[model samples]
Target: MEFNLTWILLGLPVAFVLGWLASRWDLRQVRADNRQAPKAYFKGLNFLLNEQQDKAIDAFIEAVQNDPDTSELHFALGNLFRRRGEYNRAVRVHEHLLSRGDLSRSDRDRAQHALAHDFLKAGLLDRAEDALRRLEGTAFEAEARLALLAIYERSRDWGQAAAIAGKMQQAGQGDFSTRLAHYLCEDAQTRMAQGQFDAARKLLEQALATAPQAPRPLLELAQLQQRCAQPAQALDTLENLARQAPASLPLAATLLVDVAQATGQQARVQGLLETQYRQAPSLDLLQALVALDQHIGVPDAPGRARLVQHLDHEPSLVAAAQWLQGETLAEEQYHPAVQKALDHAAKPLTRYRCAACGFEARQHFWHCPGCQSWDSYPARRVEEL
Candidate 1:
């Protein structure tokens, strides 16, 4: 107001000095923050390497507070929460990362994948499935698909499993033909259980066509054919199975006998069994032959002799148990107890065992119940294995 030029010039330098001081203060504050964040991060790393998870988590929390924009810190914290069984916290952390608009594409995909794992670990299958589905077409696509396949299998959703498997197959992930065939066979079983025999047969046929070299579908189709009163067709299927997967004939021997009897092709089936036994010398084939002998009223001594001859090949306790059942020991009174003990010992050997998990079952399985592995259980019994 006074129009003093001297005072105006002095005021300009004062303002410049004040502005420089403010800038220095702000720079110091930022440098302090950067130094503190690294110190906290390094402390967390040290704690983690020392296996002190609780203290490490606390240090990481401090780091994250210092550098709230760090996505890697968030991921580390989320993974730690998951590993510590704090799935809810892990989910929240990952979800927060996903909600941020500034996240990179790869980081967002990572967050989604981590969230899905959290849901899966928490046993929230539906939520896990949804999260996993969002990861499709991302870098995690194959992993997501595999996890989805496991979920579908655990839920017995064979149709969904098949669809995922088909996608993976088309993607050239691996040869899923055997797995796809398993899904079809599983669906066929469900159809059979619902008394939809025609549909079941069609599914089994499709399974066979999908993987002709696979033994599971062939065995299932043969059994289904036998159940449908198509004895001739059943015999033909079993015959085809014997030719294609001769190693799996033990799994189908009893069915083959039944089919042979139903179709009055006993001699042909017996010939097939004899030929198979000569090639593989399976106890099951011998059992089927003995069954055939009994059906025709052959003398008991010959069956016992046949079992004795089996000792020349594989020294099977089961065969010895069978042979002892017909043998007249010196002490006939002790025969019952001896045979009972031997039979009991051999019964365990007759059970099928999963090669992968070592879970044993009285019946053979294409899919292992213990470890959820497909084709883990061999067609042969524990004794043969």
Candidate 2:
């Protein structure tokens, strides 16, 4: 039963050889599996680059199947699905990623973000909001807050919008004071509609305090004052607006005329309008001045005469059209047709246009309906722009 040294040595080498061969075989199998995943991934990338989205999606799906545990592949597939507007599939991929216990904190946040976007794209706002709320204190917090802000704005939930905007402002994400003011003004309008005059006035005052230089709050507050039959207060508010933002006079010019007539401050408002017109000649200012003159019965000129003077100063088609309306033409029959044509041409010119999206409306908008941008529309009319 004594052990043979020669046999023992020979068995040792044989065992070593077998183990080496086994390791090499396992390595080749691993390489073969990796090769399939990589090939599919590359094919997906190629298809994507070629703008063949359907083929790209198929290739990515194949890649994901080959490498089921690969986090990067899962992320890629989810993003691709989202891009293709397949929110359900995208949500499934991201949810699967979240279910994996091996995922890092950052990767989990990323998956969560992807899932939120999936919900958002699918128009599941309630779920999307919940998902987005979870991203707070994560890297995507700022983005999520902005998304929530947009949702609030779309829903006309001014209070929620204001809250988000305030957070963003406090975070130094960007200047949201003007946006905050707009939110307050919007809420004030709602209150005014509800016959909560005092509440609306307080909100507008808060808006003015929130952004003193913003023109909307001042103008809105004055309008509310005029509605409350506090014409003197409204006139004072408008005068403050003029002093603060002289360039925004056109927006307040009509309001000023109304307040002036109400408060018997036509002479004072005429001085302000004349001063503003001297600084920047706007059709609105000219019109306001002419109206004031007509109200006070200025001995210098009639409204038509003032329009003519504006024509001399600016050579405006709008001015000419206004002046022509009151004048008696030599061919009275042709006057109606000429006036009709002029009115038609001048109609579009009176509209306010958004600087951001070129959305034209008869009334000016603080927020652009087309592009959802705030302060996009200028105070001046389309013709002035």
Candidate 3:
């Protein structure tokens, strides 16, 4: 019995010692693993700081392998891949992170956003939209919504764009009234094309109510009214536009003449044109005056004289060309060639210039074709501007 008790006591000490040694070995292994992860991470950071992207990626891969659970390392590697245009790899890393069970809420949201951006950059708009839509009610909601807005705009989905803009407006992101008005105007244009004039008119009216100061809806509404043979209403709409946004009157100047002739408001229209022309001698406004004078019984000599008078105020080749068209040239045989050259030279100057990008187009655009900015084209022509 004594011998058995002695063996038991010795076995207890030996077992405890073995357990202690095993624990120590495990602790050492864990420490080594932890140290290796940080070392690899630092090495990657050093490579990144030195702008050695290739080496940085290698080191980051090592770090990720060492500590696969590190969400931050995964995020960094994904972002690096995306920056290098390795969208496939970036997408994989971000998707893997998203699949991790241990990822925090914020980290998951971040990974989701990154993945969406990857898809967007990859031109997988459908996938990107789906990813972004999933981000609603998260911290990335605002950014996701903005991206969705851009997507809808690019696709020309006016109804969806308007709904998103409405939500953004309600959320107080910024004043989306003007943007909303544009969507309505776009919808109205489509309706007009589909032969739905009353619907178009109603939409335009709503647009005007949404943003009274916006010029596009008013201009489009006037055009719709004229197209439906509601010339008086069209004239009244344009008159309001002249009162509210005098600068944009030049855009509708030719239309103004037609509406005036149709509605028998020639005197009132002529006065408005002359007053506006005096305030701003745009070539377009001058053209409106010329048309109105011709329609009202003003003599051709006086009508041509108006262009000559404008030439003194602005050094406009366009005006000079117009004045020459009616003048009696001494070399009448060569007048055609000279006038043609002058008209050709004045054509580019008459184009509208984008205020944001300096892109010139023959037709004025509410939204710039070059930069996709709204209201980028000023009311004046390149020569006047």
Q: Write the per-residue lDDT of candidate 3 for residues 204-233, one digit (tens) a residue.
A: 999999999998898999999899899998
Cα lDDT of model 2 by residue, 243-331, tens digit:
99998879989999999999998889999999989899999999998888888977645777878878887868888888887788898
Clashes in model 3: which pairs?
none
Candidate 2: worst-modelled 10 consecutive residues by lDDT: 297-306
The residue-level lDDT of candidate 2 at 12 comes to: 97
Q: Output the worst ten-in-a-row residue range by lDDT, candidate 1.
A: 296-305
Q: Could you give me the TM-score of model 3 versus the true structure? A: 0.88
For every model shown, what is its TM-score relative to the native structure? 0.91, 0.91, 0.88
After superposing candidate 3, which stretches have Cα over 4 Å from the reference? 1-35, 328-334
Total clashing residue pairs per candidate? 0, 0, 0
lDDT of 3: 0.91
Stretches off by above 4 angstroms in model 1 are 1-26
Model 2 TM-score? 0.91
